[model samples]
Target chain A: MVSFTAGDAVARRPAKPGRLSRFFFAGNGAGYMFLAPWLIGFLGLTLGPALASLYLSFTDYDLLQSPRFVGMDNYVRMATGDAKFAAAMKVTFIYVILSVPLKLIFALALAMAFNRGIKGLPFYRAVFYLPSLLGGSVAIAVLWRQLFAADGLVNSVLSVFGIDGPSWISNPNYSLYTLVVLSVWQFGSPMIIFLAGLRQIPQDMYEAANMDGASKARQFFRITLPLLTPVIFFNFVIQTIDAFKAFTPSFIISAGTGGPINSTLFYTLYLYQEAFGFFRMGYASALAWVLVLIIAVFTAFSFLTARYWVHYDE
Target chain B: MNDAAHAAPPGDTPERPILHSVLIHSALIGVSFLMLYPLLWMVSGSVRPADDMFGGQTSLIPSQVTLQAYKTGWFGLQVSFGTFFLNSLAISVLATIGNVMAASVTAFAFSRLEFFGKSFWFALMLGTLMLPYHVTLIPQYVLFLKMDWVNTWLPLVVPKYFAVDAFFIFLMVQFFRGLPRELDEAAMMDGCSAWRIYWKIVLPLSLPVLATAAIFSFIWTWEDFFGPLIYLGDIHSYTVQIGLRSLIDSSGTSDWGALFAMSVLSLIPIFLIFLFFQRLLIEGIATTGMKR
Candidate 1:
């Protein structure tokens, strides 16, 4: 059993000045105590796996057998020998580059359109935002596959216009485009961010511009565009990271094949195949490390460049 | 124009402009149709008789509707979706409870308490936010497998207790930071323990943000398929998403109607939650974005 002193409650009072000097030490110790779980997860789970992968990048450790340290073997294989990895890289880059910019443009445009005083604005915003919430799920990816199939809804609609649609998810050449369309369709989250940014723009500026006979286009370019750049930069960094980490759609749509001759094999999907499918844990670990480095490099580069472009109100 | 602006607000009249109202309504209606089309198609496709599912044109309305698909889907497969919904609900609720309690407690410490390694630990927490789950998935799975947690809700629920989600913590911290420190100082002057202040003061005032977190967590967990798919291999343990996927994979003849019905049903909880918490969610999201 526990016993409490009469002054246990009184002990809650603010520490004395002499003792307060030790507050940082006391607080730091308590803070670390509070952070213990996350720190343990980081050091034990994240750090261990991360370092293992980096080391394994130099080895050939298929899951069943012991990993043999073959320095630079996997890197060499990737750099010079592996053609499919290169193909996967190309497909992923194209998807990211095309989808990211288009998504931003669409989201920003729609946000601007909806930012005007409109009735039932919430309903409209919710409608546009729904697709993004559903975007990354297996069900949505399955829905994408069904919608783009030869005898599916898209083709059925196309048939009315006397034009036949290609097998969207099946055709290697067209499959990537379908995925790009899928990415654009789920532009809701970015649109929400843009909407939030739009709301922050003071109405007085626009009114002043209107009084000065500034065209809507000119007003957008001079005021709205410059002011919204920070939000845009924020969205760009997040979307780019998300796009690079894309997995669910390709996994579900391809039925784990990544096929139609390996068209939709995303980086993370390929990493899964290596680790889980081929039992190449060591190589997969190496790939994982490479991905980390790539993400870090891209993120660092973005931050380095952000100084020139991103504007802060304060 | 200057005289009119001085006399009364511009665009203020005895009544709202009929033309503007019409234009707004029309635009909203048009966008609503676009937003709801795929979902509508999914519903219609799920209910239509097998022969009429792909009958001809992409009609928004179904030619023939039947509940036979739902009937067959429920009992046809060795697995049933009723059980799957139960699985999803149980996991979602447990995860939500764990997340709210653990996240709020930790957020309290980070926000209100003066402690050592506060900034360093907070930075570490934020750093975890940027680390993609893909990097951790294999190891996490391997860890679970070794612990014999596979095919159990343990894998799904345990992380919630540990405050694995930095986003929620960050959000709650921001919410708690907005609260006045005067409350804590006054409570201290009156000899109130930190825990008491957190319980009596912070928890009560933090309801709005907590509600926001709860709503998002429930929806996210409900819709989550990947974690359940990877961890729970047993058919009996399948969540709705996994159940639907398995149905599609196992059925000799695809039952589009039943799949669509289940999909519609699956979206219900999220929509209902949104309807109930719409204002809170809107304000929460708006404020969080603005604060950032």
Candidate 2:
């Protein structure tokens, strides 16, 4: 009902004598004026840095000296010689794959439970969402480390049942899993999103299915899951992206080493270590680009495959 | 919206059995406890005496509650935790102000004013939303290092003033677009400049979204570890996040009680924000589908 394009604004203006007058009278000046800050940021911070990083990726640049142009050397090294690079990729993929779906599933389940007209919905929602709000904090990561320690709360809980739990944070095999659990623990945001999506499903659809004697579980599969696929896709993409960029937990948990045999070596952590820890700025830039490529490919691949699964209300 | 419609309708009649209701409530309660367990444990651990801090104790209630850990943790490091809190508070406040102001200004342009290449810039902004920060991390660091902005709060705070966070801009734009055009048209007919309209009409009417942006900006800035860790080398300039990390690194689990106490102290601000602003935070996430 309200269309306010540049053309519409121009049409609302009085007839002008010349191009110069039209340019002066138009909204362009005011628009650009308002956009100045964002524009400066986009150029100077985002786009400029992106391109510079791309260029820097080709060279061998430590922070202490000028970059040497060694085209494709970094890529070749990553592909052929670097075991840690491979390990980091393996660890990151495992993290992203395991954490994203697990988190989303937990989110969706809790969201569904919350949507069932519970008595204290807001309180429950707030309580659940608190962890997510705090999940990215250094405190939570610190808490996570302590929780998974050998004599930590998790093992303490296990010991009560006459079972000894492994030292999760220090053990390479279990350390990544601890991070994954930490991730799944903060499923509140996606749960909120899923709850919002669930509310949008028409009640009539369920009503119609019920009249046909469809079971509740059947109704969920036939009606709810299909209709909720778009939200699922959205959450999938977003959670996957966020999981890929996850740093604080691993950084804090690993004590910034990504060690205990580099088992918890997240890609971002690896990139951070290379750039800052080792001063391998050029190699870090290369790692950064590789990460961007991985994400882009994954996103594009998801979108390409989305038509097979994601349903829209056409 | 009747109560029946709001209830679980597809599975049964409007009135459910007492057993089902009890089951659901208990399930929810159990899960909620499980969810809050770690946080609660940390709080308990913080108050516990140093000797009782560890050794397979998962009790929510401490054997003996003491403020000694708080005292020790507050002054444990070279720079007091209080200084880190002040540093974090300063950065978060400045960053929040810059983010909300710049984002609202930019959103006004995108939503209300029309300019050449508007679509192009809008698309670019959206693209940045998905672009990995890693891609820009090295170069931005180099850029800041070159400009001698690394050690100061400039690297952490100034980009916010320039509206580098495209997510906030996008969020505000979505909020601004929903605002009725009639008000803008009326103001324009009254010969009000675009700035006057934005500052007077739109911003005043956009308090909820403005508040959302401000709250999120502050929380995110406060919670941010990477930025401060990378840029702020001086311990005195460290944010709460960096300070917490430094606690672990310096003490190396020798003072778990102090560590737990400092951790609890660090979370207090966020917990307070959540307590006071739960509605705004929830609605903001639900409406925009933005991650916290």
Candidate 3:
């Protein structure tokens, strides 16, 4: 590390009496000073709040009343009695399952297309990436609502073909699908990562495959895909975590309702409702901890599974 | 200028080149439309009258254009577009500055310095990248709330000084690592301190990557709705996205034209930043990746 090297360098240089030692100490002091605000923030803001939330989760803290130690009552109630929580879980799981795969495919497909020595590459890259940059914001969520409402642009477009389209955002059963589509549309970030990975694949491999009379499709599947696995795995892990924690769109589109029938209610959205909306901070803390556990388990599972499929070159 | 341009095709049909060019252009054009359509529609809808904004009667050009929506949205602090823009700008600019300066120092330490636990510390930083931001949200929120800092910009900009975002650190580290060590070594031989070397020599050479980090942090923090939404309760402190969300009253009937107009305006700053810094980002990525 820089700190140790600088210390040694100071000790070795015998210039002024204790000047080098003083400089070394000064550097360390400066580094710590620079880190002070964040350290304070972490200890006071982050760590303290985390502990409070954990303690509160085991109590009956309704914001107004002094928290009574209820000892896992919130957990038991959520796990056993809360059907809405169950529905939210189901919706979020379905969303993660549906969105993650489709988003990966879309990103991968676009990345591959762009990788094929396209002209105006930067222009295309910027254009495609703009959506992801805008995706999770309230503005985009509102746009999604308008784009999917019965009298909205999508349905109206369908009307031109004499095919009536359903109200995608308003229909309880179909509402979640609108969110899924939104997820798929914001494929830019993963696509950029994929593009970077694709460039790392040796061009010589393709040349050799071509020499062996391999078709483009065969080369892509045999060479491009296998080499791209590590990046795919990375994207998968990040995107899955992101989709599970998705909140803004559902919150905005549903108008903080989590309905037409709680179909569009994501896990984070529900947790937020419990914490802020309903003032059930204790229950929300439990829900937050559950989410962390779920994500950890899923991430660990993927990392474990990566050995079978993810092809790390080195 | 280059040998590839003049190199003749080996045993290829004359028509192959022309056909390939055609195919590539056609595909590019098709893909371009797919990327541009939604944005084009959004822009056009902002100008179009409500009746002409939707339907089986969609046109590439609006039948009637109006500036009334823009006038109403921009000047009307009733919804507070001006305040929100300033809020987003302040948060994003401060966050970007913190990210650039702090990330550069941390990355310089990791890449160039040979201190104790260097690898361990580096790995620790990388490990933090794997931990989802969601895991830290509850704790971070509580921390700020306890300090009575929840409704302020402190929560948004302050933690960035700690190099909390390992991605930016990783990015800058890669850039710093790619720089020739001879510069620092030569400076050291001339009795230059490490801080002086970083400030004068390395930092100057790292403008490209720093620009990349700055632009990225600006765009990401600018568009971050969640942080502003949770931390800032007062309407005056709402960022553009949150402020836009507030426009939709409980009745569910929002002024569509005004919303879209504000959306278009909100996008301008990001778009301009992207246009300015994009070349630097592309060049930095290409050179840095190729270095090792």
Candidate 4:
């Protein structure tokens, strides 16, 4: 069947020189006509700006002045001199590490629970997904700030327990964790994805496992976990990338300062501060390149390590 | 298949005991309530009298409901919140239209047409999906600034018209690929132009994907904070997010009622979208494996 289809496709290809030329011309013309907008955007917006930013990273370009080439000074300064850079990196890494795994775990557990033939699955799914839809909005960040305030609902709840709670948003030691909680609160999307992934696993697998006297836990480990690895890997990479780019909650919560001693200064927030707040465009460009590199390395690492864990049916 | 074969036994029958079902329901209910607590608190606080907003009141029910906060929050700032809403609506609508139009055509080209460097361009397009926006942030800002587009919606809306959002294109491409080739082949036999085929045939059949892209684009653009915060300097031009942020800066927790009121108001459009188009939204996410 495959060879037949291959032969059919080859036969359909334009064979005569004149016909082939006409095919090429007409195809290219129509294709380019349809692709004009994307082509323009690709060249003018994406590729052009990317290359310009790369060049800008090595120069001292404030908004007013033309770029003055400064070689690797910005990169060198980031490596050796910038305290806030180091602090931002620490806070962002902590956020990504704490939030992604916790969110995925919560998502997977809830997904498994929902997969157990629960009633009103759609209702529960919608209720769970509400947070993720609204979570990235500025209002949610504002709500988060108030929720963790000293006299806010959290403290009020803690008071009922006869325990005093420090101001989670204001206290430097706890501020980043508040943001982490905020990220984990929006685990709804991943949970939904996991639910979809769960549905794809054949019921026959479980039926077979049950007949073999495999315990529920053993069946999960032996069947579901291995099957769900691809989805897990996908969620891991996407969530990590997203967590690294997290800015709005930290921005609104920190009031654009990333303050209380920069405890919640996300890496993107720091990049924004450098680019817009201080107009240190060159340094900010350098920071942006570093971020791109970091994401690239992480993505490449994920793909490389995926072979060992991410099971696929061939 | 026979009815008996079709009606297979439920897996893990022992686990489906009444008590187990009860436990699962109760656990989900408890977690759901905890998840929604903050939002409920915000809603309750928004209605409570300004004086009653503080002093650690954690109740979901207000002592007395008043429209005072809504009244104050609407006209609170130098420019009323109505203006911000209008601004956000205009931007989101224009951006969504532009994104759907541009992405559809681009996806059609990739899915239905053969051209030189097709695979290479498709690969590049996908590469952009994983490229961090930060890499282009500074240079784009510079380009827009040089064009005297600062404090305007041009920077936000124009690139979308150029199909800068590769995710939408990728989504449409996936959908377009699933469309039967026989339809296009039949159309071509009738002497239909590629444009006509895309416009008259393919697009009508692609309402689901197109609607998915439009809904997501509008919601994401409306929720976007960083773009408006950077580009828009004038309060009159503030998006809903910027206006909400400014309200916080101005109020500084002194007027929690008004802040919460405005916050609630900011979320209403998104809430309405979720309430209405939920099925499409869920199907979109499930098929694409994407989150907005």
Candidate 5:
């Protein structure tokens, strides 16, 4: 089916310029050809859905019939009437507020420890990072459920001290805290980033501080904290977005119910329930836009104030 | 003063401080136990008798060991767990190949070629990395449902061919920028075309990032639960994650040992991949964070 010219290989010699070359390949038409895959995906999957959701937010479709026009009704209902929406938002905020700081603190602490020239850095990094790599998995979520069962490990350990620990995953008062622990436990990702940042700091600065009679605490406050703030801010933004997107763990642990008095009802989980479980696709679309607005505001607020605290030495 | 200066490197802690190592190492080991104990207990729980699993006794090992849980859990409800594993492997491998090829070619264009709206396209690609999936989930699901692709791997695997993962494209773009342009010029001087230079030069030199993209794609696809959960409705077509979740939901605690057994098995492929490619995985993550 295919034919090759005999002199074509010889025509690729280094000594000559062909007349039609520049005219044929003048622009980056081939480049666009290469980029066609992503270009199509952007138009079809991302932009199309984004616009569809915006339009869907204004209607009342439930995947069964045509979406009835109900402009601002969904927003008004969510803002004033939906108790579950309020609860899910509250739980999500609590998760982001508590888990972000705790996870960052642990990450920074471990990164500093690893910077102390400990041998077997790879071993520790591997072990610490394993949880994060596996944290989003169903197996880990199921394990969390089993680990905090009424007669599970935590209660058994508490009983050893003659203390009674409530059923962690089942109790409303304790379930959210258990999820927070799960978030905190996977501190490996931020820890690794912090470690990379720690490695970037000049050692001579600390040595100079040491010679000037600055204590270890002073050196940390003066050198490490100020310099590491950029990485911290970066991690903060990423982890906050991630915490808002938390779903699999709570979904698996709560058996897709978001129950136990709605303690562990995350925003995405609630959005999912609206779209599929209850077939409230239009409501879920509104909820999705609200989530986008929430995330964009947080990200913009961080960027606006970043110059004050997130110092970049260079 | 001279002795102190010459004692050790500046990054090292104070000399003759054995207590420092002791404190740091002990804390790491203790917290490491807290981090790892649940997974270890799951492995142990999968082997013990079903009655012993939920009991008050919390031994790390059982008084007796048995494989009956594995036997029953493998058979599962109707189809076996092996079927799930095979399904995951087939999907992950194909998706990985698709993503790596698409991402690398896209990155090649972004890094090496100049066209209209190039910067805008690059920014848009980076923007997709942060846009939450929920924004796009509904319409994509609707599209797939319309196409009757709901219960198949098409909904899951097809997007990778279209370069749906912006992160990989970003990664490969960074890698491609690091490559020198002299090789391209030399190839052009020898009358080679752009495609020839891409196939012969850039790709050969950028193997590391390509491998990095493939590894991450495979691992993520293998562990992905939400996508498969939303798309696949047939039990016979279940991936391992959906299978595990169904087990938990269906029987509750009627078969704790079997559920634990299946859970432990589900983690094996990721565990092995993580073990062998730890360095590459860490490098990929570290570079993604620090460079940006």
Candidate 6:
């Protein structure tokens, strides 16, 4: 890529870029000038809040009262006593495991179909991606609620074959699955990413496999799967992180409560309830730290395991 | 669009045996139906009378299409939906502009300038991508509350001005890094300052990514519920997302058709944006994912 350099013809500036020169006239000053916004954000909005949240995790600071130091009480409660936290964790892990894999499978399948060289390829891509574009909106979440009601479109569709459908948002067992379906439905981003990955695989590899008398399935496993691993890993890490952060649908569909016996209580929703609803800022900060830890552990695990499976030809 | 992307590779004939072609098309068409069905139902629901919205009626077109829902939902509960739309548009447009501008300058610095601790800063920037927003929510809220910026759009919009959305900045950095180094050198030889090189050379060439940033920031801000939800209290300050939420949560006398109508109306702007910039968004997302 891109790099700016003084041309060789203008070769008089070989002097050292010391403190005074760096501050006054060197590229560093200009560079930092350009980075002012992000720099300020890093120090103030991001780094400050992040560190504060860590400190806040040990205190009982509701908005009304000044934070009183509680010394690991929040952690103790979370680890040892909070049944709701456990339930929320269970619900979220299940949602993430179920949704991420299914969404990726759908994305990969369609991307393969698109790569088969369909006409109006962009149009199809846009149509499929439409859900994802609107996926996080309250309108879509509300629409989801209506679509899965006992009297709603899903049951209506099911009734054609003379079968009944449950009130997906009402039943505790099924409410979480409805959110999972919503997650799966918004597979368009991963689909496009998969398409890009599919494009990067050299056609010659498939041709070479075919020459070796490899069947399509064999070629897929040997050539496609291995080559696609890096992209798969990227999607997995990004989507898993995203799945863990899912809020709008859970909040909107469940009407801001982790209702129907707390089945749809995503971790973020529970965190929200703790912080905003109950104004338990300390407890919520602890929950937030746990989330960061969970994401970091999973990301680290993915990178570790990636060496075994994710092949990068470069 | 890249020519290489569209230009099919040699011997990659898409037209194949009849059975295979039929099967593939059937699968694609079938799945496409699944993909489109929810929106179709939503649109249909929007047009139907309240009584006809649910309960075993799967028809995409009702027997008698009605505008009653539109008429009612447009006014909403007390405040008309138009005010919410304007509020959403104001927030979204301002945020998009801030994001695009902030990301450009920031990306320019990271990509071109030899700065101290650049790698550390870059890593820190990327680290924020996975730092759950919940960590930032309370302190920032507290900070804003102290500033008396709560009950205002500042809490939602101010961070964009600070390049707080690392995703867009990262995306732009990737795009900028992909550009040819020679162009910058040649421009620099003509005595173009780094700012000029950035403003004239880099900015012009980086339209695709900038546009991508604009579109995504717009869509996300428009759809954002949490920030506005947390910061703004009461309906008068509500963005469309919060407005829609209130409409949904309004007690027992819920009007399904009106709700559907309002929902459809809410989706229209995003739909139009997606239709126009569908290619850019797709490519942006792809590049962000695969290139990284």
Candidate with better lDDT, 3 vs 5? 5
lDDT of each: 0.77, 0.90, 0.77, 0.92, 0.87, 0.87
- Which order, best to worst by TM-score? 4, 2, 5, 6, 1, 3
A75 Cα displacement, candidate 3 (Å) = 2.8
**DockQ of each model against the real complex?**
0.37, 0.81, 0.32, 0.79, 0.52, 0.61
lDDT of 6: 0.87
DockQ result, candidate 1: 0.37
- In terms of lDDT, the poorest run of 10 residues in model 2 chain B is B2-11
lDDT digits (tens) for residues A112-226 of candidate 3 = 8889677778888887777776676676777788888877778877888888989888888899999999998888778777888899898889878877888879998999999
True contacts kept of 3: 0.27
Better of 1 and 6 by DockQ: 6
Q: Tell me the spans in candidate 4 whose CA falls farther than 4 Å from its real position.
A: A1-15, B1-16
C-alpha RMSD values across all candidates: 5.6, 5.2, 5.6, 5.4, 5.8, 6.0
Query: Which residue pairs in candidate 2 collide?
Result: none
TM of chain B vs. native, candidate 3: 0.90
Highest lDDT against the true fold, candidate: 4
> How do the residues B113-192 of candidate 6 rate in per-residue lDDT, one tens digit apiece?
77777899999999887787888889998999999999999989999999998999899999999999999999878977
Q: What share of the true interface contacts does each candidate keep?
A: 0.31, 0.90, 0.27, 0.81, 0.69, 0.83
**TM-score for all predictions?**
0.90, 0.95, 0.87, 0.95, 0.93, 0.93
TM-score of chain B of 1: 0.89
Candidate 3 chain A worst ten-residue window by lDDT: A33-42
Instruction: Give the TM-score comparing model 1 with the true structure, all chains together.
Output: 0.90
- Residues B1-292, model 3: lDDT tens digits: 2234323435556677667767877886787686667677778888887677654655668898988777766754464688889999999999999888888888877787665455766676676665546556665665577689988999999878766776778888888888998998899789887788889988999887888888878877887877887899888788988777777652254566777787788888877876777666545434432100
Candidate 4 docking class: medium
Local error of candidate 1 at residue A121 (angstroms)? 0.6
Pairs clashing within candidate 4: none
Docking class of 6: medium
